[model samples]
Target chain A: MTGTGRETTRGAARERGSARWEARDGARRVTEGSPGGIVLEIAGLCVDYGDGPDAVHAVVDVDLAVHRGEVIGVAGESGSGKSTLAYAATRLLRPPGIITGGDAWFYPEAGEASSRLNLLDASAETLREIRWAELAIVFQSAMHALNPVLSVEVQLTDTLAAHRPEMSAAARRERAGELLEMVGINPDRLSSFPHELSGGMRQRVMIAMALALEPQVVIMDEPTTALDVVTQREILEQVIELRDRYGFSVIFITHDLSLLLELADTIAIMYAGRLVEVGPAKRLFRSPRHPYTLGLLSSFPPLHGEVRALSGIPGSPPDLRRVPSGCPFHPRCRFSLPRCGEERPQLVAVSADGERRVACLLHDGRQSPPAELGNPDAGSVPVAPMAAWGPDGPDRSLPPLDDTALSRPEEGVTPHA
Target chain B: MSYLGRRVGFYLVTIWAAITINFLIPRLMPGNPVQLLIARLQGQGTLSTRAIHALSVAFGLETHQSLVAQYWHYWVQLFHGNLGLSVTYYPSTVVNVIATALPWTLALVGISTVIAFVIGTGIGILAAWRRGSWLEAALPISTFFTAIPYFWLGLVAVAVFGVVLGWFPLSGGLGQGMAVAFNGTFISSALYHAALPAVTIVVTSMAGWMIGMRNMMVTTLGEDYVLVAQAKGLSERRVMMTYAARNAILPSIASFALSLSFVVSGAILVEIVFSYPGIGYVLFQAVQNEDYPLMEAIFLIITLAVLVANFVADLAYVFLDPRTRQEA
Candidate 1:
C-alpha cells in the first residue's frame, strides 16, 4: 500500500469535497491531510445516561476526528454506545443522555469561517441555525423518522423553508424534485404520504431530505439497518456517491462490521462504551490488535473464504450500570492478562507510521514482557499485506497470561471518564 | 372498487340501517298511534266502532296488515314526504312540529357547539404546548366539570347566576309578555333566556375536548417524526403546530364531528333543566304526552343528524389524511 500512498491520499482528499448532489454555492474545497480536512473533532467526549451512581455510562472518555468527506464507520454491538457517540457529537442527545464532557468543534472549510461552531457549546439559537443548514443527520428507522401525516414533498421542503426562508416556493419545489431524483426516487412521488411508499423509498426520501440543504457533515445512524440486503447496498451506494459529489463527510454508524469494512474509509470498533481500536478499514480488518476486535471479527461469517463455524463472542454485553472496573472488556477477553483486570489502556500507536491504534494491554510495551523477549518484534502484529492475510488472520490460539502480574493505568487513562 | 365508491356505498348502507331501526322502534310500541288518538277523543264523546276504524285509517295505522307490509308502507309514506300526524297535537303533521322546534335547537345547539370546539381545541393546543401553566394546572378541575351531567351544570348555572345572582331569567326561551315576531326585542330576549343553558353545555363539552386534545398532543410529541421535524431546524412554533398538532388534530376532528350531533340531545337535558323552548324541550313534551309520531320524527332527525355529521367528518379526513386517499 505504501507504493501508492500519495495517489490514495490525493484520491481521499478529493472524496471529501465532492458531495455536491444538489446545486449549492459558497462550498469551499478542502485538501486531504491539511488542517481543514478535519470536519468534526470530538475530544474527551463522555456521555452518561442518568445522574450519579445509578447512571449508565454510555459513552466513556473518547477522542475521534472525522476528516472532510471520509466515511467514518462506528461498529459495536447493542448498548456499546456507538449510536450514543454520534448523537452526543451532533448535540442531539435528549434529556438523561447528557453530554457530561466533550468539545466537538465544527471546522468550516476555507472561506466558510462563520460556521465554525462548537456543537456542545453553541446556544440553542445558534444550534438551530447550524443544525440542518450545516450539519444534518439521517436517523434510523425511516418508517418512524419520516412524518406519517406529511407528504414527501412537505417533509423535504420543511428543511428548506426553515433554513432558506427567502427562497420562492417554485424554486424550493424544483430543488426537492432534484433531491428525490438524486436519491433514485421519482419526483412525482413527492405528494405521496409515508405509508404510501415502500420501506426503501421512505429511507431514500429521508436521505433526500437530509441532503436538501447540502450539509457539510451528515451523521447517519444505521440508515440502512432496517433495509434488506439489496436495498441496503443500493442506499449505501447512493450515500457514498452523493458524498463524493457534494464533498460532505459522513459518520456512518452500524453494528454490521462487514458492511463497514466494505463501505467506511476508517472503521472504529467500540466495546462496552469504550473505543477499543481505530484504523483504516482494510488494515484493521486484516489486523485487529484488540481482543474485542478479534472477537467481533470472528462473529461474522466470511463471504469470500472457506466457510468456518461461526463463533459468536461468549456472554452478553456488560450492563452499563455495573460496567467492570479497569478494561470494560476484561470479563469477556479470551486471552485476558491479570494486568488487563487492574489497568485500563489508552489508544496507543501499534504500526510504525501510527496509522493504526489499539487499546489492549498486549500492545502496551510498558507492561508487556513480550517486548523484552528473544524476538525483537515481540507482541506486535506483522505488517502483512491484504492479499497475504486470511479472513481469520489473528493468532487467537495464544495462551492466557499465567504471570498474574498487575500494573497501574498505562498512558494515564483512568478507569472511568 | 375505488376509494370514493367504497366510502359512498358504506354510508348508504349505514343510512338504510339507521332508518330501518328508527321505523322499527315506533311500530314495536304496545299501543298504536290510533289508540292514543282515540283516547284523547274519548273525553269529547264516546266514539262508535265505525268512527274508530276511520280514525285508525286516518293515522296510517294498518293494524290488520303483517309487520313486513306495514314497514313497506312506512317507507312508501316517507318517500312521499309524509310523516304521520302527532298523537298529542292531532291536526299537526310530525314534520310541521319538528320544523317548528328544529330552528330553535339549531340556533342554540349549533352556535354553542362551535364555540366549545373552537375554544376547547385552542386552549388544548396552548396547554399542551406550554404544559406547566395555569391552563394545564386546571386540567383536573376541567375534567371534573366534564364528568358531571349536562343538566346538572345547567341547574348549577341557573342557581348561581339566575336564582341567586338575579342576572337572568330562571326558565323559558324568552319573556312571556314579548310578542312572537321577527323584531329585535324578541330575538334579544330569546338569546338572554338561552344564555345560561348555552353556557352550561359549552363549559362541560369544552372541558372534554380540551382534555382529549391535550392527551393526543402529548402522545404526538413523542412520535419519532416530531423529533425529525425538530432536527430539521424548524422553529419551535412550526414544529408544534404544523408537525405535532396537525397530526394530533385528526382524532379530535372526528370526535368533534360526532359531538356536534350530541349537542342536540345534550340540549334536550339542558332545555328541560332551564325550560328553554328548543327541540329538546319539545321532544320532552312529546315523550311525556306519548305523542308517538312526534317522538318518532325527533329520533329520526337526530339519527340523520349524527350520520350526516359523521359522513362529513369522514370526507374531511380524506382531505386531511393523505394515507386514506389511496385508491386501494
Candidate 2:
C-alpha cells in the first residue's frame, strides 16, 4: 500500500479474478492440509533493486511452493535473480533489493497441525529463531562462507549457543562433533581453521555447520559449485542422504539443469525475473513446454543416443531493469508468434494432470503473427550450431564432448562461446 | 608450536642483524667525537703527541688498537650496559640520558596510539556499514587530519590549547624545574606537558586508521562469508564484530605495529616544536654536535624496536588470521 503502484499482489489478484489459465500453478491457498506438506509458500513476491520504474525488477510478482522432504531445484542464468529470491525469502537481501510486495509463509512444523508464519513480516526476534533452527542455508562459496579466523568447532557451536542455550558446553561440543560426523568429516578436524582444509573439505565443513541445528528446511544456493565433479557428486549424495534421514525439504538453486536432473525431484526454469517453465524433472526433461527450456535442453546432447550438434539460444537473457514488454522471453523465443509480443503469458497448465505448467503463447493455441512484421517464419530461424551453452554453475568447467556422451540437464544456460 | 618456534628463531636473527647494522652506522660517519671532546676539554691549545695518545686511551678509543679488537670490546661493553660517554652532554653517560627521556616518549606515544586506534577503528566500522547515512558524514572530513603532518598539527595544537586557551603549558617536556619522581604531582605534571603532542599524534594517526579500516571493512562486507553469517541468523552485532571487524582489523594490526615502533623514535619534529625532551629531542642534539656514542645508542634502540614490532606483528597474524597458519 505504501509504494507507488509498480507492484501487483498476484496472490490477491488471483483471488479476485479466478481466470482459468491462472490454475497453472495449482491451488496456492496455503492451508494446513494441502496436497503435499508445502514447507514454504512464496506468493505475489516482488523484489526490485532501487525504486520506481527505472529500478532493476529483480524478482517480479512470483509464486512458488515448496513441499516437505521434496528437493525443489531452481535454475536460472546468473542475473535471473535465483539467488536474490533465496536471500529475500529468508529476509537476508541487503540494500537495493527491496521486497516491494507479497508474502513468504513458512510452515514451522511438518504435520497438518502447523500454523503458517509470514516470513516477510517476521520480527527480528522471530526471524532469529526461525533462521538457523528452522531454515538453514549452505552458502555458495566455501572460502567465504566459513569464518577464516574461527575454528570449525566454534562456527558449528555458535548456532547451538545462540538458539539452544539450555544445552551444556560439553553437550554442545559433542553435538558439534556428531554434526560433523554426519556430514562424513572427521570430528577431530573441528579445531582446524577453514584455510587448513582443501576446497572440497571446506565445502563439507560448511555443510556440517548448516546441519548443526537440524533445521526443517535447507536452502542450498550452489553449495557444491566450488568443488570438482567427483567432489560435487559426493557432496550431493551426502546432502540427499541427510535430507532422507531428517526429512527436511531442500531448495537447491543452480544453473545446470543437468546436475539438477540427477539430484532434484522438480525443476523450475527462470528467465529474466519470471519462471518460464516449472515441472517434474523427468517429465520436463522428456518433453519441454517452453522454447527457452528446449534451447537449454538442446545445448546438451543426450548420452547413449545419436549426438546432435547443440544449438545455442540466439540471444542473451533479458536485463531485469527494462524486461521486454510482453512475454519476457518473446525477443529470443524461437516459436514466438505476434501474440507473444502483444500480450503477456501467464503460467497455465499444459499437461492433462495440471502437474506441468508453461508460460508461452505457443502452448495456449493463441499465437497469431501479425502480417506487418517481416519474415512470418522468423521464429523458425535456426540457433547457433555447436552450441556451447556452458552452464554458469560455479563448479561446471566441462570440456566439449568429443565422442563421449555426457548426461547433463541445464536449467538456464546461455551459450558460452 | 613449531610455527611459534620458527617465528622466535626468525626474530632472533633479525635482531642480531639490526644490532650489527646500528653499531656500524655511527662509526662510519665522517667525524670522530674523541677529537671534538679533546678540543673542547683542552680549549683548542696545542698538546704533545703523547698527551693526544693519552686522551684517546682515556676516552676508550685508542687508535693503536685493531678494528676487530675494538669491535670485540664494544660488544663486551654493550653486555655490561655501558653505552659510553655522551659528547653533547659531556659528563652524563648515553644510557642515563636515554633512560631519562625514554619513559616520557613511551607514555605519550603509546597512550595516544592506543586511544587513536580504538576510536578510529570503531568509527571506520560505523562509517563503512552506514555508508551514505548522515550519522557518518563527518568521517570524510576527518580524513584531512591524516593528511596534515605531525609537526604542523602539533604547532596548531600548541597555538590553540597552549596559547589561545591557556589550558596547558606552552613547551619543554615538563615544567622547566619540575621534580622527577614517582609521586602523584610529578606524574600529573608529566602527563599535562605531554597532552598537546599526544593530541596532535592522535588526530593525525587516528584518521589514517579510520580510512584504512573503512576501505578494508567495505571490501570485507561484500565477502561471501559475511553473507553466510547473515543467513545463519546471527545478530547484526555478532556478525559485524566476529566476521567483518575481525577480518578487517588484520591489515590494521600490521600498520599499527609499524606505528608502535615509531613511538620510540618519538616524533622528531613534533618533539622539537614542543621543545619536549624525549629521545627525539636528544637525537636532535646528538646530530647537531656529532655525538657518536649518543647517536649510536639511540639508533640501536630504534632499530631493535622496529625488529621487535615486526616480529610481534607476525605473531599477531598467526593469532588473528587462520590463512597464515597454513604453512605450519
Candidate 3:
C-alpha cells in the first residue's frame, strides 16, 4: 500500500512532466489520476519444486509490492527464478512446483473500496474468478499460444463467454471488434485463422485477448522476445499506451534490460531466487547498486551512446541445489569481500534514497567503514566511496578480483580493454 | 502434369518388371507345373515320347523357341488379359479365377478397413480431448487388442461367436444354404456370416489407428494455435475438435489411406486362416498348387491396388492440408 501512495505521487509528477512538455510539437498529454494504479502486495512468498533431494528452492523469502498504472520489470538471466516469482504472484505455477509459503494479495478498485483477494490461499472457485477477470498473462511464444485451426473471432469470443456469459452474442462481437481496433488490428481479419496472421499480429491478438476481460493486472513473460526488433517496439509501445488509456498494471518479465529501460516504471533485479534490488527504472539503470545488477546492465549493448564492447557476466548462475555458502553471487562478483562469504545480507533500505532498497553487504549499514585494500601484495586500487557502500558491505571472506583472476580465459569474453 | 506423366510411365515399367520376375521365379523352380498336371492326369504311368511331346504342345510348352520369343508371347497374352489357363485347375482361366476371388477380398477387407479407420480416429480424438476420463481409459484396452496377433484374434472370435454362440458361420463367404448370387438375400446373408471375422479385423486394426491418432492429438494440443484458440475464449470442446483434432488428424488420414491401399495384401493372412474363400484363400491354393498363371494375376492386381491407393492418399493430402497445395 505504501508503494501505492508513492505511485500516486509519481503519477502526479508524470502529469507535471507531461504538461511542461505538452507545448512542444507532438507532445501528447499523459493523463494522471491514480487511474490504473492497483496494489499487489506479496509477502513471505516461498516456492519449492517437490520434496527430498530432488527438491528445489526455486523462490525463497520474496516480497514485492507492484503498484498499478506502472510497468514493473522483473529482470534476471535463466535460473535466477524471475519467471517463478511472476508465476507465483499470479498463483499460476502448477504441481511439483508448489507454493510452500506466501500470501499474494490483490486490491482491485471497482468504484468502491478495493476488493482484497489472497491468491495463494484462495479456493479454486476464487482462483478461477481471478485468473482471466482480474489477471491475464501473455506467454513467451505468441505463435505457440494461438490455435491455428480456429478463427481469431472464435478464440476471442470463447474467453468472453467464459468470463462474461451474460453479455449478448451481438454485444460480445461488438466488444471483440472494439478490442481488435484498440490493439491496432483490422477487425475484418477476425475470421482469419491464426496461421494466416503474422507472428507479431498473433502476439497482438494475444494481448487483445488478455485485455478482453479488462483485468486489473496483465503478466507478460517475455511477450516480445520472439518478435523482430521493429515489431517488438511497436507492440511494447501499443501495450504501454493501452495501459495508460485503460489503466491496468503490467508485470513485464524479460532478460532484455534495454527494452525494459524504455518501458518499465520500476525495475526489480533478481538473482539466484532472491531479489537483490528494487527501485525506479531510471535510478536502477543510471546507477545499479547490486553487483549482479551492474553485471547485467554491462552485459547488454548500450542503446543511446557510442558503441562499446559488450561484457557478459562471468560464470553461469549457481546451481540451485548447491548454492554458494553466503552470498549466492559472491563467486562471480568483481568487488566481493571476505564478509560476503560469511553471512547472507538481508534486503534493507539504501541511504541515498530510503525509498530504494538493495540486498547486498556493500549497502548494509549507516556508518560502515570503507573496506581497506587488505591484500598486501596487490597494488593500490581505489576503494569505493563510503556513500557508495551506503548501508551494506560484501561479506568479508570473498577476495576482490585481482589481475590474475581477470586474465583468466572464459566463454563469452573479449578481454576487457 | 509432366511429373504425373513421368510417374505413370515409371509405374508401368515397374509393373512389367515385377511380372517378368514373377514369371522367372516359378519357371526356375524344380518340376514343371505342366509335367505335374500331366502325371496327375495320366496316373504316373510311363508315357511314350510321342505322347509326352503331344502333352507339352497342348500345354503351350516351347523349348525350340528363343527366350525373347517366349517373353514376347507372354507379354502379348498379358496385355489382352489372357493370363493363360491354369494347368493345375484344368479348364479354368487365370482371369476367371481372379474375377471370382477379387470382389470377396475387396468387400471384406476394404469395407472393414474403412470402418475401423473412422471409428478409431473418432475414439482417438475423444480420448485425447477427454484425457483422465473413461474415454482415455479405453486407450490401453484398444492397444492391447492391437498388439494381439491378427490370426490369433480371428481364431478367438470364431471360437467364441461362431461355435459357442452359433451366431455366425464358421468359414466361407456366406451361409451354407444361401446360393452365391448378387441378390439382396445372398448379400445380406454373406454379410451376416462375415460379421464375426469382419469385427475381428476391425477390432485388431482399429487399435493402431486409435493409438496413433491419440498420440498425435496430444502433440497438437501443445501447439500454439490450440492455446491461442483457448485464449480467444473458444469453448474448450470447439477448440479440441476444430483446432486440435483437425490438424492432428491429417497425418492419420494419410496413413489410413496408405494402409487401405495395402489392406488387400493384409487380408490374405486373415482370409487363409478362416478359409473365407477371398483372394487370399485362393492365392494360397494357387501357391500350394504352383499355379503360376493364377499367382501372377493375383500379384499384378495387388501391386496395382497398392500403387493406386498411394496415389489417392497423395491427392487426399493435397485436399486436407492447404500447405501442400500452396507448396505444389
Error of 3 at A354 (Å): 7.9
lDDT for B88 (candidate 1): 70
> Which portions of model 1 miss their true places by more than 4 Å?
A1-36, A110-115, A305-309, A348-355, A369-416, B41-54, B62-69, B126-135, B177-191
lDDT of each: 0.79, 0.77, 0.74
Per DockQ, what order, best first?
2, 1, 3
**Candidate No. with top DockQ:** 2
Across B150-247, the per-residue lDDT of candidate 1 in tens digits comes to 88878888898998999999998779877668999999998898788888888888888898888899888878788788778889999999888898
Which tens-of-lDDT digit does each residue in A1-417 have in candidate 3?
A: 999998996787678445432322224333653434446766657777887668788887676777766688998988888888877877667556887665677875422124566777777656666676767889889877876545788778778887778998988888788778888999998877667889999999989989888766788999999999999999999998888766677899999888788888888888888888877787677667788887888788886878877677899999998878788899998878798897787665553334356777765544442332111111123323335442334332212212322233531122211
Model 3: docking quality category? incorrect
Over B1-328, each residue of candidate 2 has an lDDT whose tens digit, in order, gives 7888888888888877877787676566776877887777777577788876875765567867887787788888889999888989978999999998998788888888889999999989988888888636767677778778889988888899889999988998777787788899888888888888988888888888888888899999999888888777887898899989999999899999998998899888888989888898999999898888898899989988988898889989988888887764
Indicate the DockQ of the complex predicted as candidate 1: 0.52
Q: Which ten residues in a row are the worst by lDDT in model 3 chain A?
A: A372-381
- Top model number, lDDT: 1
What range of 10 consecutive residues in model 2 chain B has the weakest lDDT sum? B51-60
- Cα lDDT of model 1 by residue, A315-405, tens digit: 8899998888788898987777887887876665565545576777666543442321112222255532223223432221212111111
True-structure Cα RMSD, model 1: 8.2
Docking class of 2: medium
| Candidate 1 similarity to native, TM-score | 0.85
